[model samples]
Target: MYDTILVATDGSDSANRAVEQALDLASMFDAELYGISVVDTRRYGDSMLSGSSGVIDDLSDRAEEVLAGLEAQADVGVTTTVRRGRPHEEIERYADTVDADLIVLGNRGLGASGEIGSTAERVVRYIDRPVLTA
Candidate 1:
């Protein structure tokens, strides 16, 4: 009983699984699918010592590439977005903006400490919407 489904992806193997599941669900429910890939710009903060020169531009380019690939892979029509910011924040904001009925994402690996992956965990914590992590 979903009208709009938001799928957050990072182009990782785990994310690909999430994408597949999202697509299937969208098709089954006859819901409009919205896809997004967020480029985490925080990792490339403006620090000369970090040597992250041009990192933002590079990430933007990569986001475009990832979104394009996702669009191509989805059999159903997908509205896709590429954003730059904290991954979870961007995903949550987009979901709210679209009033998505469900948010789908992958259990992309964990941080060094072995907790749930930061992005997925943050999305689950901050967004008061249904989340399906594959």
Candidate 2:
């Protein structure tokens, strides 16, 4: 029932599980799989160390590494991306751009300290597509 499946990863354990689930679903439906990791630029406000300190670059690199790992593990071809912005917004925009049929996300990610990550919660609330939290 799914044509394009998108999974948001943060390199956290739960995110890894979500990736696995997305991979399986994509395989089952013979659908294309896309992975995205977003660097939350909001965290680094307008502080003196925001853009000039290489913090964003480091975060972007880490995000790329996460997507690379996801691509490596998938048996089916996977398209991966890294974005900079609010996690939920970036994820939603990317999903819409890809015309994804399903979105998979971890219940909690690296920055989450509760039962559900804020980004996942926001995406679930605002995005129109079906979302599965692993």
Candidate 3:
């Protein structure tokens, strides 16, 4: 039973499976679907080196492109959000802020029994909301 479902995606194949599953659930319950893709802004290898680079725009643009694809596949009531921040924290905070009934995410090849996968694993450890991993 869910009203507002939040689907956290990383633009990955695994996350896409989660998206498809969430869409099916949303359709079944006639629930509103909310999709989000988070872009981690924290500097990485090159960023840490302070080398000549301008990848933030690249990342944001790429996210928007992916989000656009997601928006196209989402249900009629589904809305899309593109955020820039820590993946796990952003997903958890957004889910809480929206008062989401369910937080659905894909297991990034890291789930085994009680042990969760990468992104989902982190979100589970911090979020108080109910998480549905696919």
Per-candidate clashes come to: 0, 0, 0
| Cα lDDT of model 1 by residue, 47-108, tens digit | 64267547767777877787788788878899989888789889989999999999999877
How many clashes show up in model 1?
0
TM-score, every prediction:
0.88, 0.95, 0.83
Number of the predicted model whose lDDT against the real structure is largest: 2
State the TM-score for model 1.
0.88
- Candidate 1 has an lDDT of 0.84
The alpha-carbon deviation from the true structure for residue 22 of candidate 2, after best TM-score superposition, in angstroms, is 0.5
Candidate structures ordered by TM-score, highest first = 2, 1, 3
C-alpha lDDT values of all predictions: 0.84, 0.91, 0.78
Give per-residue CA lDDT, model 3, range 9-47, as digits (tens). 767667788888888989999988888887776535545
Top TM-score model: 2
lDDT of 2 by residue, 1-134 (tens): 99999999999988999999999999999999999999888877867545485888888899999999998899999999999889999999999999999999998989778688898889899999999999
